[model samples]
Target: MSEEKDLFQIKSCGGRKEADEIKKLLEQNDISAEVKEREKDFVVLVPNSEDIVNEALVIITSQEVYDEFYAGE
Candidate 1:
């Protein structure tokens, strides 16, 4: 018998746009990701593995992207 694994939340965004952007970024880098809406926050989920999600988070939170995304804000 096969067992299904639960998705783990890697990050949370304030809205759909932000969540979709993050999802696209991860997908572009060959990592599978999804956005789940919980109340007003959008959560980024991946398979139940820490290494992949941790790497994704590092890329997403890097200084270059952070500056580009939030420079004017």
Candidate 2:
């Protein structure tokens, strides 16, 4: 079988919880993603494809906005 393709970092989150939330959002949108903890930061990773990476970024940005807005309530 062929080797598994590498995942590229698309976003850096503050912590594991935030990274997991973003990863879950990406998966919910049918885009595969994973979270990697790098020292004090969490990095979100997705397949090394341009289209998927762009889509994931859009979704992550939207979710972050929504979260920030609602978090103030």
Candidate 3:
């Protein structure tokens, strides 16, 4: 038997504000996203890969989505 492992890491630093902001932005654009991982000093948003549908979730997404996240900032 083999265990599962993530291909990449979505790092989030600074604070939760960035993570929350990113989520709201991606959702608004209709780009499915989620918080994949989180740490005391940072948060991680790993995008959904075709390999794993309900497994590896997403954090931040496309350029448009990213733009929206920092729309005001």
Candidate 4:
């Protein structure tokens, strides 16, 4: 099988829980996101959405965005 390509990344986060929150947010918004869980850290990716992803690049790495993710939780 060919390796998959990701369109976005969670460049910075305080912890895995935070990253997971972001992942959920992306999904709730109907945006596909992925999480790579590591021993010490995690990474998140925005795969794609039926609607074009806008402001994603601007908000993906912001704590404020992550806050919204948790607020939804």
- Candidate 2 vs candidate 4: the TM-score winner is 2
Top model by TM-score, which number? 2
* Cα lDDT tens digits for candidate 1, 1-73: 0222567787889999988988888888887888889997998887677788788878788834778889878
What count of clashes does model 2 give? Answer: 0
Evaluate residue 56 in candidate 1 and report its C-alpha lDDT on the 0 to 100 scale.
Answer: 83
Across 1-73, the per-residue lDDT of candidate 2 in tens digits comes to 1223667788998989988988888899999887778998999889888999889888988988998999999
* Error of model 1, residue 27, in angstroms: 0.4
- Evaluated at residue 28, the lDDT of candidate 1 is 89
Winner on TM-score (2 vs 3): 2
Clashing pairs in 3: 45-59, 46-58, 47-58
Worst 10 residues of 1 by lDDT: 1-10
- In model 3, the worst 10-residue window by lDDT is 1-10
Score every model by TM-score: 0.76, 0.80, 0.42, 0.55
Candidate 3: which stretches are off by over 4 Å? 1-11, 50-73
Q: How many residue-pair clashes does candidate 3 contain?
A: 3
Model 3 has an lDDT value of 0.49
Query: TM-score of predicted model 1?
Result: 0.76
**Candidate 3 to truth, TM:** 0.42
Q: What lDDT does the true structure give each of the candidates?
A: 0.79, 0.85, 0.49, 0.62
lDDT, candidate 3, 1-73, per-residue tens: 0212432344465776776666566567554445444446545444445533333333334544667879969
RMSD values, in order shown: 3.8, 2.8, 6.7, 5.6
Candidate 2, residue 31: lDDT: 93
